[model samples]
Target chain A: MIRLEGLTRRFNGRTAVDGLTFRVREGEIFGLLGPNGAGKTTTVRMLCCLIRPSEGRAFVGGYEVGREAMKIREIVGLLPESPGLYGELSAYRNLDFYARLYGVPKQRREENIERFLKMMDLWDRRNDPVGSFSKGMQQKIAIARSMVHDPKVLFLDEPTAALAPDSAKVVRDFILELKHEKRTIFICTHNLYEAERICDRVAIINTKLITLGSPSQLQREFGSGKTEVQIKNLGSRILHAVKKVKGVLKVEVSGNKLLIQSKDPETVNPRVVEAIVKNGGKILYVTRGAHGLEEAYLKLVGKNEV
Target chain B: MRFDRVWEIAKKDMASVRRHRYVLYGLVVMPLIFAIVVPMITILPFLSAEVAGDNLPPFAPPGFSVKQATILAMVSLLSLIFMFIPAFVPSVIASYTFVGEKINKQLEPLLATPTTDSELLLGKALGAFLPAVGVTFASFTGMVILVDLLTLPIFGYPVLPDLLSLVILFVYCPLIAILSVSVSVFISSKVNDVRAATQLSGVSVLPVLGFYFLFLGGLLKLDWVELALFAALLVLIDAGLFYLSKMTFQREEILTKWK
Candidate 1:
């Protein structure tokens, strides 16, 4: 439900978001992954119409970014990177304030506040001022505030950052429940494992969006033909002989060990095993060491590190 | 457009002010000093006249001999506008309403709402300016009452607010408040520090001080025509500054350059 085309935001002489383009489909959890200062938050700000883009346009729920910003605001809920909350007000008061802002009806305001507070499991502390809340509790209130109006699109910036694992799990489950309700979510985060688990498709954005696909698709696209073959016992001479096998590129040896690096594991793995068997070397475990999303992210950002 | 939301924001801000009892005390301290302390000091010489045996100089200004009571009332009223009122408005209203919220990061969600920029501006102005005008008006009334009671026996007349004084209270004070707050809001949006915004916005009072000095030195008088002209000038200044404020309110700059 969100589309960004060549969206760029520059401050002074520096580019914060540089020509970024991507689309988030309906009912999908789209992860915008980046390191710090990698334009993730800038991109989200453009999509939410919190700021005007310098070079391109973004659409949220069919509303143009700058032209229909008010319309976009009505239907898209945003949880900013910082928990932008009035600490002086109680949790209930904070939610009530936003519900009224979004034009939630008088009759439904209290009900909506109560429902989200309960959903966040913060009902007991609803009356206490948010200034007294823990960071996790405050974030929970922030989430409740964002959900009070139940907008069609939710732009969450680092929703689970700094939370205890239990609290993060609570937020994660709540996000998944939102997807079940068919709400589109755009999550900008550095937590790759969480993104890999929750996002339908992931986009690795270093200086720009280097790649966008499902986790496995990216793994296959960037992964080399490196394989791991463990043997119980093999000498240096035999390891060196296995390195000469077809498709085998490199080799290393520890005490009674052999590590083979190759470009074609299908040809090299069986060949190494046969050579080891013929040389009376015992085989233990054979596996391919395909690159994971974490490896992919490191590689992508690493190449662009200035 | 939803008054309820605006009401909620305003009420919430008031509640926050209440929680900071020091700030609440700060709001009233200047008024107390101008309205009560200064008037009492003016009456102290009269009350101790019998004990001191006519040792002190005349309490009224040298050339103006209207009455001691009249002098006391006018001094307190002028002091209220010149010093106490200006200091009170910036600290209690401008800082807390605009800069404080920006520093605390509370403005983000408020801006993220479907509320128009004008609505947000109006709501913040109402939240700060109404209370400022209310407190200043209450102090003016209290000062007049206290001066009347204190001087009724001495000067054979009750202290009264002259037409110029009323105009200052109703017209000039509100204009100054709007100017202070609008400048504070603009500065708050441009800066990340609340104290800087507050300090920067407080500079608007320097021109008021210039006028106070000129008036006190007998170089400028609060005659009907001069007062009306001054009122017109202040209103125009307020409007122009407000327009500049709205023009320079770059939302994109707030999102990016404020860092």
Candidate 2:
């Protein structure tokens, strides 16, 4: 639903986003992973037509950026890094104002405002000024505001940044619900765990696109190739037998578990399982040995910390 | 530009401005001073004066006694000061609507809407203009009633709804409002802080103040032709400032450079 070809942005000769090329398909949850100054916000702004791309081109829902910006804006919703709400206004008023700006009819505007506010579980406090709400509640209202018109694509920058863990879960589930409804969701976030949980595919970008793939695909490509096996009956013979399997590059045995490094875990894992079972080791569980997507993301982004 | 979107924006801004205490102070306090306090101070002296019949000042128009002419001259000159009310009030509202919203990061989502630049500008301008002009007119009404009531016993005629008051209320107030809103819009684009934008916009009323002073100091006369000329000059300046404000109010610059 969104396409970028060599999309670049520069401010006063300093490149914020450089040659970013990617596509987010319809009903796909695409996550943008980056650290500070990674041009994630800039890329989203370009897609939303809030700013023009300095070089290259982009299309959002078939509307060309800079040429059909109004069309793009009409079809897309944006939750900026900050909620940017009118603090003095009630939550209902805030959403209603945006619905009107989107040209929603009076009847539909009221319906959407009520529905979204209820979805956020903020219906009881709809009459209170948003400034008085907790940060998490305010973020919920912001998310609701973005979806008030029910646009085809949603661009959310740090959707759960300010929420507590429970509130963050609510937003995450709400996003997953949007995905179920077949809306294209493009998220820019530093929360890798949330990205891994919700995004169908993710792109790691610094100034340019460093890597793009599903979370597991990236873990395989960038993570150390190791398969972990937890066996109930600990045996040195099982370790020796697993090491002799073809494609098994290295093996390390710890208490009640084994870490086997291989070039291709898909083919080698079954062989290792067979080797362990044949050697009288009762295998309880077998899984990839890497530290999840976090390790792969850190390795690909070349950062030791978030 | 779609006017419904423009009106929506204006309506929302008005609602937002209503809750802002600082802007509310400007909306209520400035008009009160212009309508009630200033008139009470200016006309009370003439009401207490003993009759000084037929010793009229040279600048007074042909038919009036000295006391009558003094009251009319003071009221006429002071009516020009009412022009300053529209010029000043809009700055208060626009500062919050533009710079306050900008600082609060509210403009990003607003700019992301389907509305065009002209519609947004026109909406915000009207949002500031309407209240400013409304208050000015209300204050003008109050001033007319108060001045006439005070002058009625002495002169046996109402001193207001005169040509000067009509011209100032209908013509100059709206133009000055447009000028104030346009200048404030321009200032809001350049300044990120609401106080800074407001302070800078206060300078916009200087020309009106200059004319008021010139007339009060007897350096300028309140003639029909001269008033029309000044009104035309103000319209030209308002147009120029509005054009400049529209040019400065780019969505991209507001998003990028406003930091």
Best by DockQ: 2
lDDT of 2 by residue, A102-219 (tens): 9998898898898888888999999999999999999999999899998999999999999999999999999999999999999999998898899999999998899899987887
What DockQ does predicted model 2 obtain? 0.82
Chain A TM-score per candidate? Answer: 0.80, 0.91
lDDT of 2 by residue, B17-36 (tens): 99998788878888889889
Least accurate stretch of 10 residues (summed lDDT) in model 2 chain A?
Answer: A297-306
Q: What is the DockQ score, from 0 to 1, of model 1? A: 0.55
Residue by residue across A191-254, what tens digits does model 1's lDDT show?
9878878899988886577889986566556655556667787676667668778888777665
Model 2 CA lDDT for position A97: 89
Task: Note the clash tally of each candidate.
Answer: 0, 0
Clashing pairs in 2: none
Could you report the DockQ of all the candidates, in the order they appear? 0.55, 0.82
* Model 1 residue A89 lDDT score: 82
